[model samples]
Target: MPETKKFLYVNRKAPYGTIYAQEALEVVLIGAAFEQDVSLAFLDDGVYQITKGQNTKEVSMKNFSLTYKALGDYDVNKIYVEQESLDARGLTLDDLLPLAWEDEDDDWAKKDSIKVVSAAEMAKIMEQSDIVFSF
Candidate 1:
């Protein structure tokens, strides 16, 4: 069997304003198809990618908040939001979308997709990654 490698995508920008977040997500979606162990880290302004109540109507852009929710369906469920990042922006889990995925190990039960961790903790995760894509 091919060894499954760990892939980590580091997001440090806001969802809009720039294309980095969207492009990173697209890469993650494609990479997930390989069944590799994938994880996403939302740091700095990147935490806003999952922020709830996103409306792009005024900007004439499609709301992609739902895209984050759809990630679970692709089995890309390991989303980590940095605590310091959220605190710095005065945001909380309540301000983010509630993303979940099916846990086959738990008899296909649904579980939350987001994991809030400290910057230090996220660094540890980054260290374990076999491939790290930073945006």
Candidate 2:
């Protein structure tokens, strides 16, 4: 693989009743397929992606939540969650996507994080990206 360029997909909305989440997920997966270095940082309501125990089937909707788990298969290894968003929603790290992480890997509990991030920190990631797509 050549030196892959970094691409960041920022998911900034809820996963239901909107195409933002779905589209963002698509870009991330396909970007990886092209051999780009794809990473995702979920902020604001986007943290819902990692919310534990979702059952959208009650609303007669297909469960896209599990699609998040498949990110690794596409080689999208960087997934970030904003800590303040989780707290603002009264959600603990425990109530988030099962694959949460920290830089130090304190939990090592899942394949991905429970990694907490901040807006400014997210901006740093954005600045470093060869392409930044926000949805």
Off by over 4 Å in 1: none
Model 1 agreement with the true structure over 43-83: per-residue lDDT tens digits: 99998888889989999877877888889899998999999
lDDT values, one for every candidate: 0.91, 0.74
Best by TM-score: 1
Residues 1-135, model 2: lDDT tens digits = 768788778887988778778777777766776887777888889988767788987787766778777776565668877877887889887876565333335453345533678867777888999878878
- In candidate 2, clashing pairs total 8
Following a full C-alpha superposition, what root-mean-square deviation does model 2 have from the true structure? Answer: 4.0
Q: What TM-score goes with each of the models?
A: 0.95, 0.82
